[model samples]
Target: MAGLDFEPALAAALTRHVQGITSVGKLTRLSGGASQETFAFDAHTASGTLPLILRRAPGGSRDGGSGQGTALATEARAITAARACGVKAPEVVYVLTPQDGVGDGYVMERVEGETLARKILRDKEFDAVRPKLAYQCGQAMAQIHQADASQVPELRLVTGPQQLAEYYERYRAYDLPKPVFEMAFAWLKPRIKEPKRTVMVHGDFRHGNIMISPKTGLAAVLDWEIVHRGDPLEDLSWICINAWRFGVTGKVVGGFGDVPEMLAGYRDAGGDAYTVEDVRTWEVMGSLKWGIMCMGMYEVFRTGYDRSVERAAIGRRSSENEIDLVNLLIG
Candidate 1:
């Protein structure tokens, strides 16, 4: 029931929200999300039939050490803040809080777009659209950074140095003897002196995290679990990281465009204070951070906190991509 039991409650909730709404049916879980559960459903309402998405933390049981609560709240707040800032985020219909006895979840409009990285990079239908997406990604990120932080106080959850420190602590807590990652950690400590500027960073900004339409290019930026305050360049570098290039490594900037175009777009969109050096440094950090985090996800799967074959596979991907970081630093 925990996995697919939300149907009855969801139907009741929908009925209350939409007058004369009734007969909600065909709720099914969607794939691709390992940290949380997502479902798409159709509902019969007096207004009309509707398609919606429901996102909630994985089950209702909160593992003592997994930082799931903060993550859930962070994503909900990010969706709200992004919409208020004029960013292209899915419209949030309702935020289910803990007190609601519905677990932590949210209902939103199901946006139509493709989130597959390779598909976006290879699809001929997006030939014209893809070229301009990098710049648009930059512009959208700039807008998110410019969002009033006060509206989303959760952005202050971590700062520059604390951000890196927290990741190290998480890895250490796992007690995994990762020599390469240890070296990367040592390299990151000194580099964390101070950022040139502080802004909201979409912690996991990259090609796969964005949804793009074959015709319109970037439709909306997804995955807000890691949203926090830090160097604006962190977001830029993250998108350009090689792992996200999806076989188009030579293109550099998310395989959609070049760095100059991305930087130029960000600069024109009021990110003038950002510098190339700043973004480069963060790019290195981005690679290391994601590599380590990928390992953490695998740990979660292995430890039975979450048992998903997809997560185990993702964990194995960290090593190959971390090497890219080593090369970037030494070469």
Candidate 2:
């Protein structure tokens, strides 16, 4: 799988399954996404060269991660369903089969945009698009939520209380005490409630998972690995988590726009009515969720399960989420 050696197997798959794909060119694995592997390459088709991305499990395993995510095929189906609902999700070109020999993953159109949270927030190039991203995110979430459940992949049904308990249990197992996490947990426990109706919730609908186009604002929503059926407010509140706002905490929505505007866009796009207070509750949960995730990641580092510096660095950010929880729950 070094250099261009990975091309032949992938090329064979694409040529056999993907229409017009004659061969592949320069398949390069992209960095980041620890749980999954991503590769960028060109499909030298009969008509033109096409840029596409292959996302798969780390070692071609059918089920990636420790039961944290759905199958790659399921993720691909969710993307297709989202796109069908008018959400700006990547177009799924092909789902890799075991016979393909590439891995357990799918091929999607390479969306052109910035996915880095800090770069999209601070870069001068994205300055013009910053102000509108939150609203666009709202619109996209609305479309995703409106998708027919029957049409999309079978997703796990997750409730707010269910998630809170799961994360809290994980935190307890870690045995690393944080007063902020404790306080956030106590504050969130009583408030967490299931919605009257459920919709497709993009479990991690934050800055990094969203693609931003300088000219068009929000491009496509990426990473549906943990997507599930839940309250739409979960998606709404997740973007408002202070950690996603980066250093620009004032904007309150992905470091770009205000909550009112985000809500306006959501409601305008046929999303259910939700108050700012509603979003605030879920925001608290989202902060607590992220804090626990950071802790779990740090646990990996602590146990030498993953000795990567990245794991340790992300573990250090748990305190940041603590501050966010304090601001939301205590302030």
Candidate 3:
């Protein structure tokens, strides 16, 4: 603590609200938030040193990558609602205001788990839990879908057409052409008919965004920035997208479980009913959406807002979705 720059301001603020926090230690930035900044640290108190995360949107910065997602306040609300529906999630401890000096964001009780896509897919430690992931994902998504928007009026409702247009506009901003995107857009523009139904969706609820424990299959669902009201099946499709499979493409449901087990779990958890055909349509849309999102990150980096190698790297991976689109649509 003597040799390094210690975090006092945040520590002091946390101490006041965190109750009996004798010391706050090791304020290490874990990674960047999807639409903000994320940090991991310890709060030393009478009980023990508590591991927690700070997700901040940096006062005046544009919500990082894209403005499509919810603000920190809405994200906190979504997490609260998800927890109420019995979904495993980080308990939001505080939502910092302009006065907190830590910027606009929130602090949450960190749940320790492996969220790395490859580790969960290949690690032997997760061998047992791997088999049950898809089912668990289904059951959890049901609970997430139940988090009604009426209670959390901060969330914006987005229809299928609206979402498609939003992504299309982002893709256009890139000003680069991908024949695959064009083909996928053409095929989907007509067929992707939404029934005007809406539900709370964990927009980026997939392998990388979800945390899993080796002993328990799923630990906590993280990243609610993109939480919105949309088609319930969108969550299912997002999970099944090939980009999330992390090399185990044979198993469609996040490269660990089959679709049948997932759907069965969904049914048992009282999720909305859907057919294979319904998922097929959404999968194509999901694939394109992921591609567009990758481009959005690239745009952020390319525009000189935030220079990160990871963001630049992701821009190239959009081609992966291109191939997936071709296989799903024309093939």
Candidate 4:
């Protein structure tokens, strides 16, 4: 479906859904999406041009396998519910149907901001707003967790121990073992305790998934495919993972600010009272989780399931996570 024509179907859908719309214009595919297809286009209307985005599954199919996260309709519902909770999420304009001729996905308002982590961390244009990003991220995360579970579509309830067992099994399935990973698992198993309460957590609340503006800081949180109901601390710790720092390891919170500042923002936004130690424990789990995911990438590449150079490149970074784990645990 790479070269499939979407202009005709888009024109029909936009004209019908969007009031005073004429046709679609200048559809361009955006990069950096590994699982889904994303396209940006203009919906020319009688009033003015509307910037919109189309996120669809490849070949117009609805399913993306078991580990691929939720379906498109569920993702759209999550976005809508997050927006209602005051989180900076994209407006879900329309969800695509089979009769629409477009793929099984949704159309959303195109948010103008930077989603690249390296550029956001290193670029001079983002200098002024960089320091505030971590705290803002915490605030945004608080809003996401505050969303009513009933308002959003039903999501899987994944506890810390359940996630640990699941990922550990995934790691062992590849028949590859590392002392660092085994040790990390052992360290995490005993510490795994049931959460006193659960909330909607943004499963992947790291750098690239967040949109940052040069002016107002956090613009919107993108990529709701992996959102789930779980401990809110998972969102806090996932951002502190070393891999998300993008080489600025000194700044513990997404290469921008310290943990205290992030917590301050979290508290200001009415989040649960959590301490640094709580986040650190989850950080260790997050590091090991990422390491196993990297190994999975390599396994797919080696088994000829995915032959892309990008997968091979990411697979090589599994060792870096091990080094991070050693420093975090052994030190």
Candidate 5:
């Protein structure tokens, strides 16, 4: 019932496009993912009942402007580019423009697999799949980074060092008291330099954003809203963040593969120039970035854009995890 009433308009729109649409069945919103709204629905066309997913921007806008349309289009474009690069991503079926009357959303194949972060790491049934995850993650990221940024011109919106600076600026804009992050920024500012190579970086690469099957190593990588051109190491470091190790901090690298193994896989695939020092810098940056981002999430909830207790708790924990990273780096 989460999104049932909100979807009749979409069903009507789809009926106009696809012939012989008989009925649009129940539409239920899936939990998790704070930035966007996701729904699973059954489409009963003349042919058969088709399972589909609908993704729309949060509250249909950002920054007091109706630009979710553009973001949705960008997501579609990014998914296409990722698929072309041999990265496992859901196939985009339709992109709804503002004029299309869907309020900026897209329909894609509903990928079947486990996407829960902790389950992917701790589920014994996934033990075989888990060990290969880091390697697959490295390989998939290498492929994603290898993608020509020009293929998706929207990625030109942000570059490497600017991206880092932008993240910091975003935190400052939040106007939260973040002394730990302030220190992290001070430590990271001087080291912010252009990458040796600019490649397609998955801005939010981590175990939680990935999907894996117990029978298969990796099913697909979800969430393309943050795709951009930047240092490939950003993706590597984001994956290895201690927060994502699923209670296996000592294992690192998503608590499955070692750092050397991941780097070796990446390097073997022509992803040279990424060194331990480079990854360390990004790792530190990732911790800082996630911590600030968590604060932003709290702001969203406070502003009534969302009211989930989970968001509130996550925001509160951001500083603790960030402080842990600070201790790791400086202690």
Candidate 6:
């Protein structure tokens, strides 16, 4: 609040567009992400004080995060697509452009739910729904995968082969040697088939991105920056990736349940038919994909892009993905 460069601009934008908002109060800079900055505040409106969250790309451009640094409007439009398919997505209230003087970003209605991955996995308060969380995730994913993405023109439709090749190229540029990643890539290249069942995928639909309720289980899916048209099985397998298991390796699906329960939920929710082999392939691919990203992040740290302890530590996580890739591909 004391020295933030965007505070005055933010106030101006809110005053101009945010209707009936007497003022914004208790504004807090939540997270300083490289691609976008997130903030939470209360809008003192005429009716009532509404809680809201803002996602803004610092300095008017994206940097230091997932995807090719997609624009905030793309994410907002993707969320709208997901919600149209009955997925519980947060409603976007306003999108801020450069003309608004707040940079590029969007404001969303603050939802009431818990997003902590570990707490959802182990906390006793979630005991009733923890066992059912995996299936719930499957049902939610089915809705997302079935969502008509063609409605959102801003989204880029991509195929598996395209992204996989890009990942390999990115990894090579790092000049870091990873045998497991190499072998996994070698195994995946030929197996990559034309996606038989394509849908709009929630690219990063892991535990942390999901919002859960103690009474109802899955509440909403957050983070749409990387969403694109791809194999729906990729979404299914990405959730099952061991890296997102949060230390409880026994329960493969985000430390909550197994494949059968999730598949059953998917079927109940009308997701397209897919094979176990296809899912296994994507699961392995997800591990490799994450490993490549982890190593890439390490390079970012090594190069002093952000130079935080967290960024430096993320590279070490590549080993976890490597181990997972070995178990999936070789075993």
- Using lDDT as the measure, the top candidate is 4
Candidate 4: the clashing residue pairs are: none
lDDT of 3: 0.82
What TM-score, over all chains together, does every model reach? Answer: 0.86, 0.95, 0.90, 0.95, 0.85, 0.92
Each candidate's clash count: 0, 0, 0, 0, 0, 0
Report, for every candidate in turn, its global Cα lDDT versus the true structure: 0.76, 0.85, 0.82, 0.87, 0.75, 0.82
**Best candidate per TM-score, number?**
4
Per-residue lDDT of model 2, residues 1-331, tens digit only: 6544657888899999988999888788885365688889999977899999988887566654357787778788878888888998889999999888877889999989898988998889998888888788888889999988776647888888888888888999999889988988888888888787888888888887898888989998998988889888889999898888888989999889998889988988988878889899889988888889899889989999899999999998998888888888778
lDDT by residue (tens digit), candidate 5, 1-331: 4435557677777776656666677787875354577888888876688888888766444312132223667767877887887889888867776655557678887888887877877778998777777777777888888776787786654545786788887888888867778887778888867777888877777776788889988788888867777777788888887888877877778877778778877876667656777777878888887788788879878988889998788789887657666775777
Positional deviation of residue 166's Cα in model 1 after best superposition, in angstroms: 2.7
Tens-digit lDDT track for model 6 on 103-155? 77888988888988888988899999988887888888999988877776656
Question: What is the lDDT for 154 in model 2?
Answer: 71
Estimate, for each residue in 140-178, the C-alpha lDDT of model 1 and write its tens digit: 888888877776775554555776888888888878788
Q: Candidate 3, 282: how far from true, in Å?
A: 0.6
Give the residue spans of candidate 3 off by over 4 A: 1-6, 59-66, 297-313
User: Could you give candidate 3's per-residue lDDT for residues 63-91 as a string of tens digits?
Assistant: 43246768887799899998888889999
Each model's Cα RMSD: 3.1, 1.7, 2.9, 1.6, 3.4, 2.3
**Number of the candidate with higher lDDT, 1 or 6:** 6
Q: Please provide the root mean square deviation of candidate 3 (C-alpha atoms, Å).
A: 2.9
Give the per-residue Cα lDDT of candidate 2 at 213: 86
Instruction: Return whichever of 2 and 6 wins on lDDT.
Output: 2
What is the RMSD of candidate 4? Answer: 1.6
What is the lDDT for 104 in model 5?
67
